[model samples]
Target: MSRRSILRIAAWPWLIASLAVLVIGFREAIFLTPADAAQGDIGRIFYYHVPSAMLSLVFPYVNFLASLAFLYWRRRDPLKALAADALALAAAEVAIVYTTVCLLTGMLWGRATWGIWWTWDYRLTAELLLWLLYVAYLAVRRYSATGQTQTIAAVLSIFAAIDVPINFMSIRWWRTQHPAPVFFGGPDSGMDKTMLPAFLWNFAGWALWGTFILIFRYVLERRRQAAEQEAALVAIEASLEISQ
Candidate 1:
C-alpha cells in the first residue's frame, strides 16, 4: 500500500478510539459527576469547554512550529518545505475549529453562569484575539495576492504564537471575569479528585481526535500538492512537444 493509504488507514483506528473515549467521558461528565455547589450542573460545561480551550491553545503551537520549519526548509529542501507547509495549514485549520468551539462553549457557559454571553475581561478578550489571529493566518493563506503567501503567513504565525502566552497568562496575571488557574492558583486551585477522571478522559479524547484530524488533513494536502505537480508537468511536456 502507498504511504498515504497507510496513513489514511491508520487514522481510522485512532478516530474510533477517540470516539470511544469521548463517549465514556461524556457519560462520566453528565451522569456520574456531581453538580458544582456554586455553579450547579451548568458547571458540566467545564468538561467540554476546558478541553476545547486547551486544544485550541495547543494546535497554534503546532502551527507555529510547523511554520518555523517551513520557513527554514523552504529554499534548502523544497519537498520538506511542502510537507511542513501541509502540516502548518492542517494545524491552523484545526486550531480555528477548536478555538471556535472554545469560544462558543465559553459563551454558552458564560450565559448560564455569568448571565452574560461575553465581557471585556482579560482572559476572554485574549482568547478572542488568539482566535482572530489564526483566522487571519488562514485568510492570508487563502486570499493573499502575493507569491510569498506562505512566507507572509509564516511571519504572521510568529505573531500569532505571541498571543498564546498572553492568552494563557491573562487569567494568571489579572483575574477579572475569568476564574484563576485551576492547576496552579495556589493551594485551593485544583479540582476535586472525583472530577479528575472525567476531566482527564475528555482531555485525552479531544486530543486524540485532534491528532487524527491533523494527520488526515496533512495527507489530503499532500495529495493535492502531488496533483498540482502532475498537472504542471503535463503542461510543460505539452508545451515542449508543441515547440518541437
Candidate 2:
C-alpha cells in the first residue's frame, strides 16, 4: 500500500480506539467510582489529575531523549537529525499540553481539597518551572530562525529534564502542603478499593490518548517538513530558470 493509504487505514482505528477508551474511562471515573470518604465527589478529579501529571512527566522525558538523539546526530546525519528534531517538537508540544492540563487540574483539586486556588509549594513550584521551561522551548522553536533553533532547544530540553526528578521527589523530600504519594509511599500509602479500579482505568485510557496525540502530532510535523522541502526545491528551480 502507498504511505498515504496506510496512514488512512491506521488513523481511523486509532481515533476510534482513543475515543472509546476516553469515553469509558470518563464514565467509570465520574459515575462508577465511589466518592472519597474525606473529599467526596471532588476526589473524582484525581482520576484525570494523576494521569495528566504522570503523562506530563513522561512526555518531557521522551522529549529529552529525542533532543539528545538530535544533538548527537545533528552534525553527521541530516536525515536523522531532522527526524529527531521532528520527534522532539512533537513530544514537547504534547508534553506542554499535558502539563497545562496537569496544572489546571491540580489547581482545581487544590481548591476543592485545600480551599485555595494556588500555592507556591515545593512540588507546585517545581512543576510550574518545568512548564515554563517547555513553554520557552516551544517559543524558541516557533519564533527563532530555523538554523540554530533546534540545537538551542535541544540543549534547553536537556537542562529541563532536571526538573522532572525534583518535581517527583518534592513531596517526599520536603515539607510540602501537597499530599503524599499514594502508589509508592510505603505501607502507609494506599487507595480505597472502590477508587482503585476507576483510577487504573482512567490512567490507562489517558496514557493511550497521550500516545495517540504524540503520533498524530509527529505525523503532522513530518508533513510540514515535507512541504517545506518541496517549497524550497521549487524556489531553487525557479531561481535557476531566472538565472538562465
Residue 236 in model 2: lDDT: 100
User: Model 2: per-residue lDDT, tens digit, 1-244?
Assistant: 8977788789889888877888888888988887778888998889999999988999999999999999999889988888888999999999999999999999999998899999999999988999999999999998997679999999889877999999998999998899999879779997888777788778888888888888888888988999999999999999999999
- Considering summed lDDT, which 10 consecutive residues are worst modelled in model 1? 3-12
lDDT of candidate model 2 versus the reference: 0.90
Off by over 4 Å in 2: 2-4
| TM-score (C-alpha) between model 1 and the true structure | 0.97
What lDDT score is found at residue 122 in candidate 2? 97
Cα shift from native, residue 10, model 1 (Å): 1.5
The C-alpha lDDT values of all candidates are 0.92, 0.90
| Candidate with best lDDT | 1
